[model samples]
Target: MSESYRVVEPQTGVRIGFGDVWQRRELLGMLFQRQIAARYRQMLLGVVWLALEPMAQLAMLTIVFGFLLRVDTGGYPYPLFAFSAMTGWWLFSKTLMSVAGSLQDNIGLISKVYFPRLILPLAATMKELFDGGVMVVILVGLSMLYGYLPTAKIVVLVPLFAYAALIGLGVGLWIATVMVRFRDVRPMMGLVLQAGMYATPIVYPATLVPERFAYAYQFNPMYWVVELSRWALMDKPVDIAPPFFWSLGFVCVTVYGGLMVFAKTEKIVVDVQ
Candidate 1:
């Protein structure tokens, strides 16, 4: 009798394949919940911190841009202008900060587990989404308080938010991957984000960028994100064509490029540790 022969496939050492990530979906949910709870864990004010930060920033921006800087957000009230931009900016900044150090901070889990590395940054994104919901409620309340009624244009906020999330995720993925290799990226990211707050039209109107520099200025993706948010909430007229194309282009390049870099680096992540 002939002996039976069997062949076994070799393991690739790629710990985070697509199926592995899907299998761990429940872990993602738990991480999301933990992030929310951890954020307000020891704070006396608890979840109120979410509303307070944006509200305070809105007030400050309104005063500085409306009164001191004399920047016009079309005919919309400055508070509304600032608040709308703040809505998007808050989400972007929060997501960036949360994901930047996620890989490094969770090195223990990464080494111990065989789940997708992308989950770390993704969990950070989900936490931002939860925080963003609180901001939306605050924005609605402020609109009512200021007597600005919502119109059909409010529907635009959906897509505008989706675009913002893509920007945040793309940037976060890039930064998170880099921070894993170079810890210095985190502090430098903080400085860049701070400068970005002013560079972006968060507190000011996009028109303030002189016509001569307009083309060069659009390189900052946040410019379009902020502009779109204002247009959605304030019913302000915007040349959506140019900025929309710019944002779409940015999303494509960053997400693709970031993923490539992340995929390559993730394999060697354990070696670096």
Candidate 2:
């Protein structure tokens, strides 16, 4: 008599693995929809809030930097200069802030689910993208209002925006993973964002950053992304090579580290809940 051996098959449903995430794309879409709906639900201004927030910031910066500090905007109106930078910075900061708390806030689902934890942070990013689209409309209006219509260089914005989003996603993933283990990360992130607004070349042009510190300032990826937005929209000359490479390297390191950390700690995520 021949002995028979049993073969075990790996589980096939959605799980933490990368291949599983690709298979569960529908679930990611659903999560994105849920985030958008929740963000706008029961709000009087709804989507208008997106435009208003940036507009208010632009107005304030125009007054403080343009009128008070007497900053030069490369001859473009201060509102245009400030709005362009705010467009990219707002997307990065808002996406990072929302995603950092996603894991803890969605613990109820994480404990019960077999989906990729990365999905939570990624879905939060989509909400920022939706708001960013609204900001683009406002930008177009402001461009025409200031008589600074974009030239063919505006076509560069597509790739620049993609770079901006990837930077946010990579950093958001890293922060979200860390926040799960260190609850203090969230508040520290708020402080970082506040400091970043001042450190970045948002309210003023890169020319005003002083020649000696320009190299050091390039270490901040948002500085490049913000400059890219202004260059794309305003046709200004920008040093894209250094920051672009730095952003690419930073994204790779942060995303890989985030995924590994998340995979290792996810096993205990439910226990903490």
Error of 2 at 142 (Å): 1.2
How much RMSD separates candidate 1 from the native structure? Answer: 4.0
* Residue-by-residue lDDT tens digits, candidate 1, 63-128: 777889888767778887888888888788888787767788788988897677888877888888
**lDDT tens digits, residue span 1-273, model 2:** 699796656434333478867778898899988877877886867878767777787778888999999898878788888888888888878887877777888998998877777777778877777777788778867887888787887777666666666677777767776777788888789898889888998887777788999888888888887887777777768765665687678777876776676666666677765
Find the 10 residues in a row with the least total lDDT in model 1: 8-17
Query: How many angstroms is residue 151 displaced in model 2 relative to the true structure, after the best TM-score fit?
Result: 3.1
lDDT of 1 at 194: 84
